[model samples]
Every structure is written in C-alpha cells, then in structure tokens.
Target: MNVMEIRNTLGASVLCAVMFIGITALPATLAADDDAPARETATAEPPDPRLVSRGKRLYVFCRACHATEEVKGSKIGPNLAGILNRPAASLEDSLYSDALRQQDFVWDEEKLDTWLLRPATLVPGTSMAFVGLPQEANRTAIIAYLKTL
Candidate 1:
C-alpha cells in the first residue's frame, strides 16, 4: 500500500477502536473491575505480535507525556525504558508529584493495568495529567507495546 492508503487504514483503525471500545474517561474507582484482576507473572512473556502492533498504534495518544525511548528523555512524564519492573517516582530528571513519590511498588502487569485505568485515582495528585485508558483491551494492547520498549 502507498502512503495515502496507509493513512486511510490507520485512520479507520483508530476510528474503530474509539467507536467500538467505548473509550471513555470515567473515574477509575467506578470503572475498575476488581474481578477481572490482572494476573501477576514471575516472568513476562513476549506480547502477541498483533496486540503489539495494535498497541503501537494506540500509543500515539500517550506520546504527549510518556516517552518509550531513553535518548528522547522525559517529556511531561518519565521515560518508560524498562518500566515493567521500575519503581514509581524513581526517575532522577523528572519532578514527581508527592502522591506518586510516596508509592513503593514496582510496575508489574497488574499494577500497570490498575494504574493505567486511572492515573489520578492510583496516585491522587500525580503531575502527569492523562485521564487514563478505560478499555481493558486497550490497556492490554498498550501494555503489550510498552513491553517491547
């Protein structure tokens, strides 16, 4: 496919995700499903290629604050290189909110899902201003893409 075709396909895919997923910014406390609980694994498995592709597309939205590259450095949020097991508020360059700095847990899949569902709710006064990804599929896909980085 040529450039125009690629753009059209990407546009359609984004439209579909937004429309079908019912992606909304609801309060995490309200939308979080305690039962669906993200499972914790000792070692993370490679993400499905298809899911990673979908997640890379979804990550366009997150590029505003978060950076997947180390050389790129921190933007509005911290650089996410090897963030899967990183501690919260540990980045040296970025200024973190008191809410986030107080946290003592590593970023495992379960924690990531919980945090991405609603960042503000997870760390009440976080400096990062993102509302959050409410769709479970979206969260899974994005998390998958993050793993690749």
Candidate 2:
C-alpha cells in the first residue's frame, strides 16, 4: 500500500478500536457503585430484586409505626404507600409536628437516608420515636423496600 493508503487504514483502525472500547466499557462505567451516594430518580427499570428482598425484611422494623398499604390507613405514622418523592408533611389526615410541617423538601433517597440515619437530626422536635438505623446497609435495604411500597 502507498503511504497515504497506509495512513488512511491506520486512522480507520484506530477509530474502530476507540469506538469498540467506548461501547464495551460504557456499561461498566455506569454500573452501580456501592460506595457512591444514593440518588432518587424516576426510572422505567424495575427495582433490583435482591435489594428489594433484603429491604422487605428490614422493613419489619418500620412496620410498627408506618403502614405501607393505604387501606390499612395511617398507623402511628402517616400512610407511606407513596412516600418517595412526596413532600414532607403533605398528608392532611396524618397529624404532623410543626417541625416537619414548616419544612419544604421532597422525600428523595438521599434525604431519606439522612432521615433514617437520625430523624431527630433531620427534623428536631419531630414525633418519630424510633432512634435511627445506624448501619448504612440496613438503611439502604429499608429504603429500597420503601420505594417498592
């Protein structure tokens, strides 16, 4: 091949290699990293089955006060059937503390994590009696289960 032909072939080969690497590595780069902070996003994809299963088990702790089913009605806490993305203290029937009512924030995964870590810290004077889930894994599992509700 002539010099120009060799150069053209080499350039095309390099381009193909770069494209292949990007395509193959893209998913890996996007894969969930456990250490990364959790984010709440509306997604068409189904929740992770393993995470959901673990979360369901962890949710037993929350079941005493929070009812996930609307038909069950509000227990000690408001009906949490659709709590994710909901604004704080939006439930009219469920009496909320002034601390929670005065605030203006949506319940997203990150906020929920912080809340689960320590409700008192998140909202002082709030009525939630349970101390908090100290373990990050437990909190994550419980949050995952709550999302499914």
Best by TM-score: 2
RMSD of each: 21.1, 9.4
lDDT of 2 by residue, 39-83 (tens): 434434578889999999988888898888888888879899989
* Per-residue lDDT value at 146 in model 1: 85
What is candidate 1's TM-score against the reference? 0.68
Clashing pairs in 2: none
lDDT of 2 at 50: 94
Candidate 1, pairs of clashing residues: none
Query: How far out, in Å, is residue 52 in model 2?
Result: 0.8
Model 2: residue 101 alpha-carbon error in angstroms: 0.6
